[model samples]
Target: MSSQLLSEDFAENIVTTARTATGDSLRSVTYFTRSDFDQLYLRDDLEQDADLNTFVGHEWRGYRETQNAYQESELGQCKFTVRSFENGYLLRVAEDRRGVLITTDGLSMQSYEEIAEALKRMLQDADDEEA
Candidate 1:
């Protein structure tokens, strides 16, 4: 575990919540802070040795940029971001300097919203605890 800000139990709980909501289609769950990240869960079929450092760097930058991404628009602050791939979807939710990156197989739009809302609340709760 590469955790620095998140407790092991809390990180696992985050993964559990995602898994329960997304079911078997959930591919991976990663908990990340501004500078470090932990892979809480990954499906057995995937390669474990992939370069996560690069990915984490990209995600951290994305999280920071998203904060002010749409300040001039009426859509409000970003609740989350979803990136679609040919095989699956990547959902990201961030609060303050921490976030969770969830990857899952194709799921309904409702499923994505449900999980994103739940994760946003959880991340906000965690941020509140830190404050």
Candidate 2:
């Protein structure tokens, strides 16, 4: 686990991609702020949803600790992991049987396909720039 600050432009793309991919309404797509991540606690609004709470529990404890610690202690740090497709950089947030959360920004996703595509696009753009 590691933390990296995204440029505003890149962050915007990430948010847009996530929104488009998930078909999430603009208002429902909440961006994670530093404080939000720092707390390592799910938002009550999110927790209150009956559909989502089924997956919420102690399982998130480890992820919370790892993410919170990384955010606090590591700056510009990232985890390099091979996603299933093995085709792009994966900015994974959390994963479970229900869904996955990920982003180049701080957006969360419940769709694995969306996560993979957004990550693929983000990584491709980065590669193009490097070249």
The best candidate by TM-score is 1
lDDT of 1: 0.85
Give per-residue CA lDDT, model 1, range 29-111, as digits (tens): 88888778888889999889978789877987987887767767788778888999998899988877788899999989889
Worst 10 residues of 2 by lDDT: 34-43
Give me the displacement of residue 89 in model 1, in angstroms: 0.9
Q: Stretches of candidate 2 above 4 Å error?
A: 1-4, 25-44, 47-111
Candidate 2, 79-131: lDDT as tens digits: 32223323222234342211123322233444544555565556566547756
Instruction: Give model 2's TM-score versus the native structure.
Output: 0.34
Candidate with maximal lDDT: 1
Residue 14's lDDT in candidate 1: 90
Residue-pair clash count for candidate 1: 0
Compared with the true structure, all predictions reach lDDT values of: 0.85, 0.39
